[model samples]
Target: MSGVAGDDPRDPAGETKLTFPESWQVESSDGLSASVMFISGLIMVTRNRYLAWPSLLLSINSVINQHPLRTKEGGNSPISTVILGVSALLASYLPLVMIGPQKQVPLPVPEAQ
Candidate 1:
């Protein structure tokens, strides 16, 4: 009962489940982190007006730089390059969306005395 009862239904080998931390789920997490850091710096400098522009630029750069090198050297498929490019662009903007500017609530005015 001890050895057999605890066996996993799928593997029955008691192997540990494979996992990566949320912070490192994908290979592009590094790029996401960099985008977040840069966005933070931009927010510090100019608040928020110019935040999206730099993030957009960096995302484009990352996709352009990443796809060709991987495809040419690693012999990856064109579809893979397209997927990677789209993924990188999405990942870059995801962090920005998470840290987007807070919505302001207008205070209620007091009735005149």
Candidate 2:
């Protein structure tokens, strides 16, 4: 070992060998997109306006973070996730647009004795 970082007696250069996992063994699925899709499904089922907006944003993030080059052949597309998210957003808001939001009236409660 020498004071210089690249100094190696046995080898010509002290460049360290790095081992990477095989490409086939690596997972190509995007967890973010999957979760976003799940959220979209929830929004569709519940028609929650709050969840709809955030789920749409998450879908956009998923699309932006997608790496086509890194993904394996025939991998799941982010486009579908975005489409689902957008549809969920539409479903949540369309009711408000069509019928408008109803004001909730609280029932009067009797005073406790």
Candidate 3:
């Protein structure tokens, strides 16, 4: 093959460089954020203080770890995750604020021998 025709091993003139479409480019996965969001949703639904606090922390982590350029287009936003987390936290703890903590009844003490 002629070098001018790019059939030669060292010839790059006639070779068309392959380029994937912009849409074909792989975007970064949002698995951790998605999981955090899901957990936030569960926390909201259950209003469990134990789960709510950790879910908020995970949501913050997702925000901190997010990369704008590599993130998928039209994907879920980290801000939304944070909002959900805050909402979950509120849902878990708001009752205590509005209604106050329940007073514990003291058990009867036995007389000392």
Itemize residue pairs with steric clashes in candidate 3.
none
Expressed as tens digits, the lDDT of each residue in 1-113 for candidate 1 is 56776565777566777896543122333354354455645554544544545555555555555544223333333344344444445555676689899889999999998
Each candidate: how many clashes?
Answer: 0, 0, 0
Q: Write down the worst ten-residue block by lDDT for model 1.
A: 69-78
Name model 2 segments beyond 4 Å from true.
1-25, 101-113
Candidate 1 regions exceeding 4 Å error are 1-74, 103-113
Candidate 2, residue 100: Cα displacement in angstroms equals 3.5
TM-score of 3: 0.63
> Of the pair 2 and 3, which is ahead by lDDT?
2
Candidate 3 C-alpha error for residue 90, in Å: 0.6
Clashing pairs in 2: none
* Top of the candidates by TM-score: 3
Minimal lDDT window, size 10, model 3 = 20-29
**lDDT, candidate 3, 1-113, per-residue tens:** 34455457666665688996554334655888889888888877877899988888989998998777666788888999999899989988998899997889999999999
TM-score of each: 0.26, 0.62, 0.63
In order, candidate lDDTs are: 0.51, 0.83, 0.83
The lDDT leader among the candidates is: 2
